[model samples]
Target: MKTLAIIDYGMGNLHSVSKAVELVAPDTRVLVTSDPAQIREADRVILPGVGAIRDCMAEILRLGVDDLVREVSADRPLLGICVGMQALMSRSEENGWVDCINLFPSEVRFFGNHLKEGDVRLKVPHMGWNEVYQTTDHPVWHNIPDGDRFYFVHSYYAEAEGNPDIAGRTHYGIDIAAAVARDNIFAVQFHPEKSHRAGLQLLKNFVQWTGA
Candidate 1:
């Protein structure tokens, strides 16, 4: 069985993500790894996190996993979840705005903390199920239905600076980024593992996607 490394950056919900992948990709070995060298050699890599963007970046950098992330992202199939997804952006304003992994040309900012900010009725960090609308034509959403409900638990949102590597979107207060892709790197702002059956299906589809 080909091994898939779920990075143990100590910044993500590693146990749940590892279990989800193993459930869907049964034949494949899902190894929760902290060793950068092992991570580099894995068939596929998952960067999962649920925390501040700055802290996530710090953990990766301190562990030197950022370099491995850069290396793998350049040549392999990589899946980044939630804050991991935001980390791929050019910059984030979580702690006074700082540089990120730069896998995509986008910026991350916290949801406007206003209950009466125009169409933004939901609370900031938009918790719970939200419908995602595909932003571009990609193989990942090949069989996935449009406007599919996905579980979300985030305080910040991503906005593409240019044409952007956007893959899908979800409306909250206003339209917000739901997913994005750039070459071999793909990510989602929501937690597919926690989204129920469709979430599991997303994991299944990703395991068998073939990076096509």
Candidate 2:
């Protein structure tokens, strides 16, 4: 079984994520290790973080996981969740001022208070179930259909320019990036495990994915 190292950057729900992966790939060891050496040695890597983007990136740099991530993610499969997903992008609008991870050449910004006018009811930190609208076919979206609902809790969302990297999208008054992927890296702005059975299945597919 393949081993998956759930990165512990001292932020977010790392334990819950490990448990979800364990259900699908029980034989596949799910180790929560912050050591960059251990992380680089794992069969697959899951960068799970929750908090300000700046702090998460800082932890990655401070612990030297940044370099290790770059090394492993080059050819190996890597998954980022929630803030972890945002970190995979170029930058984020949350962390005090503008800051970023610069991984996929895009930036995460606040959910526009309103696209036009007369639309001021949607919550800023989009929380609860959202239906993911698919833009393209990817391994992560394997076996999943369009309009699948997933759990989400975020105030900020991701955006990309030409040559779209968006894989799954969701509507929260304003359609925003629910997931994005590029090469060996795949990220989602929601919590799969927390989303119930559908989400669990998504995690299952990820663990069994041959592409990664």
Candidate 3:
């Protein structure tokens, strides 16, 4: 059986993400664990998270999931979701300034206390559905259409203006890095588990992808 490990660093929505993965790929074994051995041995790895980058990074490092994620990402298909995606960056503007794993050379920036679109004021969290524009072609974008809406619940997003690794972009009050892809690593600022159809399709694509 193909094993897919979702790193449980005490920050992610582990149950929902594992269930969604199971729903998309029933044949694949999904493990929600912090065990380094299981993570390394799995065919695929998923890093899913919610909440602040500081707390997330603390638990990740404490559990040694940071190293395990990096190790697995080097060889197998690894998917990061929500704050999990933010954790892959070099730094986050949240909680003053916290350093991240730096898997991708980027920074997580806050949407700002006072954001606006034209005349209307926008919320900081940027909750609910928003369209994601595909910046580049990728296997993860398989059947997922460009300009499709995905569920977002974040106040901070990875900067994507000139980053070459960025695969997708979205807008609220600013340009948000919706997705980033490099070799075997694919990370998203949105939660696929809660994103409905298009999100499920993206997860399915990841399940079948060979990281090519």
Better candidate by TM-score, 1 or 3 = 3
Clashes of each: 3, 1, 0
lDDT of 3 by residue, 1-212 (tens): 89999998889999999999999999999999888888899999999999989999999888878788888898899999999999999999999999899899999998988899998999878899999999888899999889998999999999889887899999887788999999899999998899999999999999999885
Give the Å error, residue 89, model 1.
0.6
Return the candidate ranking by TM-score, descending. 3, 1, 2
Q: TM-score for every candidate vs. truth?
A: 0.94, 0.92, 0.98
**Residue 101 lDDT, candidate 2, scale 0-100:** 62
Clash pairs detected, candidate 2:
90-102
Which sections of candidate 3 miss by over 4 Å? Answer: none
Clashing pairs in 3: none
Report the C-alpha displacement of residue 162, candidate 3, in angstroms: 1.2
List, residue by residue over 1-212, the lDDT tens digit for candidate 2. Answer: 57889999798698799888888777898899887777878878888888777788888778777777778888788888998888777777785655556677777878766544254576667778888988888877777878989999988888633527888877766567888888888888889979878788888877776544
Q: How close is candidate 1 to the true structure, as a TM-score?
A: 0.94
What are the per-model C-alpha RMSD values against the true structure? Answer: 1.7, 1.9, 0.8
Per-residue lDDT of candidate 1, residues 1-212 (tens digit): 78789999899999899889888889998999998778988888899988888789898788887778888877778898999998888899898997888878888987766744576366766789989998888766767799989999998889733436788988776677899988887799999889877788888877776663
Error of 3 at 202 (Å): 0.6
- Write down the TM-score for model 3: 0.98
